[model samples]
Target: MVGWVDRANSKRAHTLAQIPHEWIDPNVINEMKERGYVNTREYLDSVLPQNEVRITALTATELIERIRTRKLTSFEVCYAFCHRAALVHQILNCCMEIFFDDALNKARELDNHLVTTGKVLGPLHGLPFSLKDQVNLPGIDTTIGYISRVGHKAVKRSLLAKVLENAGAVFFVKTTVPTAMLASETVSSLHGRTLNALNLNFSSGGSSGGEGSLIGARGSPLGVGTDIGGSIRIPAAFQGLYGLRPSHGRIPYMDVTNSYEGQELIPSVIGPMGSSIQDLELFAKLVIDSESWNYDPQLVALPWREVPHVKKDKLRFGLMVSDKLVMPHPPVLRALMETCEALRRCGHEIVEWNFPHNKRMIDVGEQVYAADFYDEVQEILETTGEPISEYMKIARENISYKGHSGRALGVSQWWEISREIRSLKEQFLEYWEKTRDLTSDGKPIDAIICPAWPSAGFRDGDVEFGCENYTVPFNVLDYSCVVLPVTQVDSAKDIPDASHSPFSTEDKKIHEYYKPEMFSGMPVCVQVVCKRLEEEKALAIAAVIEGCLANVEKL
Candidate 1:
C-alpha cells in the first residue's frame, strides 16, 4: 500500500511530468528565484517566444473572436495557453493536473469542424479554460489536495464541466485548493503551497489560489472557482482578477465534491474568476442559457437576463473602507479611496456605510464552518497518517478569536444559527431597501464597494494575518458579489499608521504584519456586491467600476 508521503510525492511528480521539458525554461526559473516581485505576464513575454506570449495574452473573448475569423487557429490558442500554464505551474505550483495532449487534440477537432461545417461549436467555441481542483473530469483525480483521495479517479465529468465542454471550451489543467477547501491560503500536504506569482513571497490566496495565480499570470484565459466564504473573491482580490460569487444555485454545484456537502445553509457556490467582467458574464450566460437547472435541480431557474441598461449611469454606491474589526493596510485603503474618488468623478454617488452585524455574522460563520470540529478533515488525515496542514490548523484554531466555540452544533443548534442568519438577512434586506430613500431615483445603491482583504496579499504562511469580517457578511446574506481590480501596492505612497492603536488582538496581529516594503507591487482590489441573485446588475456595476479604474490608471 502506498503511504501518504509516497502518494503525495507521486502526485506531484505526475503533475510535473505532464509539462514537457521543452516548455520548461531554466533561465526564467532562475530569474524568478533571484527576484521576489515580478510582473508575471510581462516577465513571461520577455522569456517566452513572442508568438506564444501574444496568443496567451489574448482574453477569452478575443481568442474566440480571432479563432472564429480564422485569424488564429484553435490549435494555436490551446497550445499557447497550455504552454503558458505549464510555465506558470513550474513557477507558482498552481496546477495539480495537466492534460495538454488531450486539449490540443480537442483544439484540432474544433478547427476542423469550423473548416468542414463552417460553424463554430457554440458561444465559447475554441476557447481554452481551466478548472478548480474539485471540479471533476472523467479519469482525472479530484483529490482536491488530499493525499487519501490521490488514486481515486472521477468516473464522470462534473455537470459544469460538461456544460462548458459542450459549449466548445477546452480544458487542460485543474488548479489547487486547500485541505477541505477551507483555508484562505492554498497549501496542502499533497501539492505543497501555491505562491503568488506576482510576489513569490506572498500568498496566492485560496481555496481558489491556483485558479487565481494561473489566471493572474495569464496562464489560463478563464477559470471557474467555488466560493463559500470568499473563496472565489479572496484569491481574485489578492491576485487582482475579476471574480463572481453568485447566489447559491445560480450555478450548478451538483456533481462536485465539497466540504460539509450536505450543509445548505451558506452552501458553497461556484462562479468565474477571469481577466475581465465580460468573461464572467459570458461564462454565466453560457451556462444559464443551456438551462443547466434542468440537469441540476439545485440550480436556480434564472435564465440569462439581457439587461443593456440594468441600472442608471448616475449610480449610488455604499463605500465600506473598514469592517471596524480589521482595518485594511495602507495600500488597500489607498485603492479603496482611489476607487471612491474615481466613481464620484464619474458623477456616481458615494455614501459611507458601516456594518453592525459583522461580529454576529463572523460568529455564525465560525459555528457553521467548523461546526463539525473538522471531523472529516481529521479522519481523512488519519487514514493516511498525514499531518494536517499548518495553515488549516491555524485557521481552525482561530475560530475562537471571537470568544466562541465552533464545536459540533447539533441539528437543533444549527437550526437556531440558521434561523438567526435568516433573520439577519431580512434585517439587511430592509437596510438595502431603505437606501433607496437615500438615492435620487429612489432605487437602492447599485452595489457596495469595499476592500476584499486587509492587505493586498498576505505573506506566504501568513494564514493568521487577516480577518474575513468584510467578506463573511455577504456570504451570510448570500449576496452576489464581484471582485474588481483597482490598483497595486505602491511603497512610495502607502505608509503604515504607526501611531494608530489596535481595536483588538486580531487587529494588532494584522496591523503589525503590514509592511509597505514586503507587499510592494501586490495587486489590490475591492469587491462590488449586489443584492441576492442580481449577478447581471453586479457585473454591470463592476464593469463601470473597472472602467473608472482604467481611467484612473490613465491619469
Candidate 2:
C-alpha cells in the first residue's frame, strides 16, 4: 500500500489546483433557476400554508398502528414528512433531491390499498423514510457528491430501495454526502454543506450528515445510511439518534455508489438510523426479515433473530473506560462514567477490559480505508470537472498525513498482516471468554461499552488527526455496534481537567478544545459493541443501558 502511495503521489501534484474555487458552474445554477430548481425562499412562501401537517418523531410501529386504525392516512403521513423534510433541506442543505409528488402519489395508492383491502401492505406501510444519496432510485438523480452527476439517474432502484418500496415505505427525498463519501463532515460540490439541525453552526457528522440532520430535526422518522468509516454511527452520535453499523454483509450493499468501488479488504455496510432505538429495530427487522437477500445477492441471508430472551439480572457486561488510543473528550468521558455508574446501580456486573493494541487496529483500519489510492474517488470527481469539495481535499490530506512509507507489502507481508489481524480477533475473543469465569454468573459479557467518538462532534475540518478509528475499528472486526445518545455536554460538569497534562501535542490540542462553552449541549454518546454478528445481543445491551439512563432521569 505504501509503495503504491508514493507512486500515486509522484503520479499527480495537487491536480485540484487547476479547478476553479466556486462550488458549481454559473450556467448550471442559471439552468437550475430556469428549470424551477431555484431557491426555496420563493417556493416555501407559496408552499408554506400547504405545510400544515408536522408530525412528531414517532416510531414506525406507532405510525403503522395509526395508519391501520385510520387516524392517519398514508398520504397524510407521507405528505407531512415530505413537507418537513423539504423545510429541513432548506435550512440544513440535507437533501440531494426531492420527490414529494411521486412519494405522495405512492402514499395515496397505499392508502387506497388499505381502504379497499382492509389490510396494510407491510409493517412500514405509509411510513416515510429517507436515504443517503448513494442508494440509487430509478429515475431519481443519485449524484453522490459529484458535479457531473447533477442530472445522473439510475435505470433501476437499488435493492434496498426496492425492498422498502415493496414493503410500502415511502421515500420522499435522498440526503447528501461528502464528495467520495470519505469525510466526517457532509459537504459536496453538488449540494453544498449539510449543517447540524440542533445547532446549524456545528457539523451534523457524515458522510451520513444530511440524514443525521434530517432525522435529528424530526423531518423523517427513519433513514437508511451506509457506513465505511464512521459514516452512519458518527452522524447518529452527533445528532443524538440511534444508528447501527451492523456487521458487514448483514445488510446488502449492492448497487450503492462507493468511494472505493472494489477495495474489499474492509467492506462497508448499509444500516438503519432513526430517532429511537425501537424504530431502529423495527426497520432492521423489516428489511432483514423481508428476505432482502433474494434480491441483493450480496446480502447475508440472516433473518433478524427474535429478540433474545435474556434477563438483566443474569446478564454480564464488559466495560472499557477508554480505547487507550486517543482519550475521549471530557463530556464524552463524563458520559461513559455516568453510564457505568448507572449500569452498576442497576445490578449488572461491569468488568473492566483494556486492549492496548487498539491503536494498531485503528492504524490498520485507516490503511485499508485509503488502500484504493482513492483512484475511484478522483475519477468520479474528474468526470464532471467539479472542483474537489473542501471536505474531500481535507480528507485526502488527512489520509496522506498518515505518512505512507511509500512502500507496499509484498504478497507475503499482506498474508502476514491478515494472519495477524485474525490472531488479534481471537485474542480479543479470548479476553472476552475469560470474563465468563470471573463474572457474577460466570457468563461472557453480553456487550461491551465504549465511546463512540473522541468527542460529541468535533469542529469542522478539525479532524486533521482522525479519531474515527474509535468507531472504524469495530468495522474492521465486523463487530456489531450501535450508537446511543445518553447525555448532552454540560458546560458546568464537562469541563476539562488539564492539570493531568497531555501525552502528546495532539492530545493537548484535543484536550484544549473541550471548553464547556464550545461543546455545550452537543450530544455525548456511547457505543454498545458486541462480537461479530451478534447484533441482537448488542441491541439488547444497548436497551439495558438506555433503560438505566431513563430510570436515573426519573429519580
Candidate 3:
C-alpha cells in the first residue's frame, strides 16, 4: 500500500542517498544530463575540488574569519561546506536532508573546541549553516513537502535549529520546500523541482526554494528561510541571493514547521539566505545575539540594534515603481530602474512611494489567508491519499477550489478579520507617516524601493501568480524587508514592452510570462522596505543599495 508515487520515489531516493558517496559524479551527472543542465555554477565548477571551490566561496562572515583566525579549521570549514553541500545536492535538487555524517560530527566538535579552548565557540565559529525544509532537525525529517511528512522525526531541535546549534553553526543541509511550506514555487511530491541555482530553466524561488538553490549554488554559506509571503524574499529573489524578511517577532518561529500550522494571520518569520550581504547581517546578528526573546516567548526583546549610519547623500528612498499590480518585467523593470538610477547617482533620495495601502492590504490578506481553508493541508491529503504535486495541484486550482474542508474563520468571522488586519495596519502607518512630507531630509523615507517579483524567475507551473503583488504588502505590513541581488536577465538589456498595458488577468500572465531571450540570465531582485521592527534598517538599506548595484550594473 505504499504509493504516493512510492512515497515520492522513496523520498527522492533518500535524498540522493544522503550524498556522501564521495560526492557522486556519475560522469559529471551524465554530462549535465547531455548538455541541458543549465549551470549550477557551471555544474559546481565542474564537480567541486579546487579546495572544494575555495571552501564553498567562503562567506558566513568568511567562514567565521577563517574559523576564528587559526587559518580555517572547524574541520576545515565543516569539510568544505559539506563538500560543497555534497556537490550542490547532486545537481540542484537542492537538498532536503543530507547529514554528511551529522555535519562531520559537528565539525569535529568544533575542531575539538577550537583546539582546546583557544576560544571561539559562538559567533558561528565553524560556519556551514543551511536549513529551510522548515528548520527543525532533531534526527531530521522536516518533510515540509509532506507525503504526510514521511518518516517523521523532528522530536526536538528547532528554535532556529537550536539557535544555529548554539551558534557554533555547521548543520550540513536541509533545504527544499513547497507543499505545506505553501507554494511560491519550490515544487514538490517531496522534491521534484528545486533547480535554478542560476537558471536551470528558471525558478528556484519558493517557500525558500531550498535556501535559494543552496545559497545560490555556493551551497550553504548562510541559510535560514521562511517568509510568509515571498518565502524569504522569493527564494532570495530567485537565486541571486541576499535575503531576509524579518519583522514578525524579529526572528524565531519557535518549533518551526508551518503550512499555516496555526496561521497567525500572516505570521511566518525566520530569515537569512546567502551570497553574503555580510551574510545578511550575519544571519540577523546571530538571531539577535540569541536573546531570542529570552528563548522564544514569541521573540521581540529586539536587541542587535545598530543601524545608525545615514549619510549616503542623506538617504531618502521610497521608490515603489509599480505595485499598480504586477508590471515589472524587462529585467525586472531594468533591475528597478538601474538600481534606482544608481541610488540616484550615488547620492540617494528617490521618493515617489505613495502606497495607498495596497488594495486594503490585499483585501485583508486574502480573507486572512483563506480563513483556515487549507483544511489542515486538505486534511493531510484526504488522510494520506497523499501524492499531490502538479505544483500542489496548481495551488489547489489557484485558490478558487476552496470547498471548505476543516472550515475555519468564525470567532465572529475571525474577529472581523482581526479588525480588517488592524485597519490595514492603521492605513499602513498612515502611509508611512505621510512619507515625511515626501522626503529629502524628512526621515520617513529611508527605505522602500520595491519589486521582489514581477519577473526575474518563473517557469515550473509558475505557481499561478503568487508573489502576491510584490511580497504581500510586506506580509500584510509586518514590514522589515530586504531582498537585494540587483541585476541579471539582460538579454542584451532586457527589452519586452511592445508598448504594453494590462494590469490584470495576472497582468497578462505577467506579460506572457516575459521572455527577453527567455529570461536570459535570471536573477534580478530589489525590495529594501523597512519600518515594522525595521530589520536593522532593512539590512542597512541592503548594504547601501548593494554598493550602488555594482556601479549601476556597469551602466
Candidate 4:
C-alpha cells in the first residue's frame, strides 16, 4: 500500500542507517567483472600459492634467492604477492587499482626468458612491486585519487616504471593518496582512505600512505614514493618501513603526475621504499645503474655505487633527539635514547645537536612550496569537485584559500628570500663541518640521527598533530634522508607527562592528544640524514643503524 516516493525514501534511510554504503554501482561492478578482476579469488588461486605457504614475510632478497635456486618459479613468486596484495587492499583500502593479469603474464615471460637465456632478465626479474598512485605505468590509469582523471591512462611510462619493467619487474598495482596528493593522510574521493595495517583506527601517512600501508603489510616487496616535503619519510616511519627522499635529481621524474606541474624551486624527488635497507639498496642500485638518463633528461648522471665505507670504529654522529619547535612524544624520545645508547655501546661517538633555526627552515619551505599560490593545485581540486583533505586544510591556512595563492610576488622579495634560504643552507653545512674538528680523528660527522616526527601512527583525521617539520628541515636543506624503524611503542612506558609544560599551543594540542593505549604496538622510527648527493654513504649509515638495532633486538 506504500507509494513509490515513500518506498524510495525508506530504502535511502535504510542505506544511511548502516556504515557508509560501499555500493559498487552496477555499471562499475559490471566493468570490473568484464575485465576478469572483480572477484580476485579464482585469479589469485590460478596464479598464486596457497595461503598456508608462509610466503608473507619473505624479503625481496630471499624471494630472489628462492627463484634463483629453482625452489620457486617467477610465476609462483609473483602470484603469491598479487594474492597478498588483494587481501591487503580488502582490509587496508591501500590499493588504487589491481593488475594481476598483467603481472602474472609478465612473470610467465620472465620464466621463459630465464630458461632460454640461462640468465635472469635483470636484478629484479619477477619481483612484484606497487607504485604510489602518482607514478605513471603504461596503459594503467594514474588518476592520483581524482575522479576527473579516473579513466585517464598514461601514454608513456614513468622513468622508474620503465626502468623496473626493463629489469623484468612485474608491476601489478598502484596505491591511493589524497585528492591533491598534498595531505598528511591518504583519503580520496576516488579510492577512499588507506588504513594502517597495525591498527585500522589509525592513519597511514600520506601522500604515499597507501604505499606505506601496502609495503608495511608485506603486500608488495617494494614500492616507489615521491617527496617534496615529508611525503615519503613520514609514511615509511609511521608504517615501520624503510623510505628514502633522495637529493633532488637523484631519481628521474618524467611521465609522473604531480600537483605542482611547473614549480621547480623545491622540486620533488622519487625514491624507493622497502621493509629493509637491503631491499632498498637493491632497488636503488639496479634502477640507477640501468642508465635511465637516456629516457629522462632530468635525471642526474650519477651511477649507483655499492661503496664499502661505513667504518663503525671511526664514525662520528650528530644526534637531534628533539627540535626546538616541537618536543617529540615520549615513545619517540625513548627510541632516540635507546638508539643513542646502542650507538655508544658500538663505539660510535655522539655529539649533542640542538637546532634553533628549524622554524626559519619550515617558514621558508612553506613559502617556496606555496609560491605559485597553489594555482595548479586549486585547479585540480576544482576539476575533481572533491573537498580538500584535512592535512591540506592546515597547509592552506599557511598558503591561501581555495587551496593556493594565484598572485605572484615582487621580484625583489623573491630574490631576497632565495638568498635567505641559501645563507641558511650554508650556515647548516658550516655547522656540520665544524664537527670534524671536534671528532677524535678530525673527520666530519658521517650522518645525523634525528626524530622522523613527533609521534608514530596517529589516530585517523588527527589534524591538530604537529612536529612533522623534523623531516621537512632536511628537505629544505635539499639533503637526503632515510627512515629506519628503531622500536615498537609500549603504552606502559610511553604515557604522557601531563604535569609537564608544552612548547607552544600546537605542541600542547599534539601532546594532549596522545593516548598510550591508542598507539600501542605502532613502530617508532628515526631519520638518518647526510649532505646532498651522499645517498650511497647515507644508505650505508642507515644499514649500520638497522643492523645495530637488529642485533639489540635479538638480545
Best by TM-score: 1
Instruction: Return the TM-score for each candidate structure.
Output: 0.96, 0.87, 0.35, 0.88
Predicted candidate 3 versus true structure: per-residue lDDT over 103-142, tens digit per residue: 7887888888888989988988788888887778777788
Ranking by lDDT: 1, 3, 4, 2
Instruction: Give the least accurate 10-residue stretch of model 4, judged by summed lDDT.
Output: 15-24
**Which of 1 and 4 is the better model by lDDT?**
1
Model 2 scores a C-alpha lDDT of: 0.75
- Model 2 TM-score is 0.87
lDDT of 1 at 145: 74
lDDT for each candidate structure: 0.86, 0.75, 0.77, 0.76
lDDT of 1 by residue, 1-555 (tens): 888889889999998899888887656666865664366666777778899988987788888899999999999999889888888888888998999999999999999999999999998898989999999998999987789888799998899999999999999999999888988889898999898867777888888999999999999999999988889999998888899999997898889988787988888999999998889999988888889888899988988887677445588998888878888899988988999899887788887667577788878887788878787798888999989888667767776564445566687888898899998898888887778777777878778988888888788887767567778888888999999888888999999999868878879988988888888878888888899999888998988887876787788
Candidate whose lDDT is highest: 1
The true-versus-predicted C-alpha distance at residue 509 of model 4, in Å, is 1.0
Clashing residue pairs in candidate 2 are: 1-408, 2-406, 2-407, 3-407, 3-408
Question: Would you give me the overall lDDT of model 3?
Answer: 0.77
Candidate 4, position 510, lDDT = 79
Ranking by TM-score: 1, 4, 2, 3
Which lDDT tens digits does candidate 4 get at residues 8-79? 244224322321123223243234345554223232333335551356567887777777767778898887
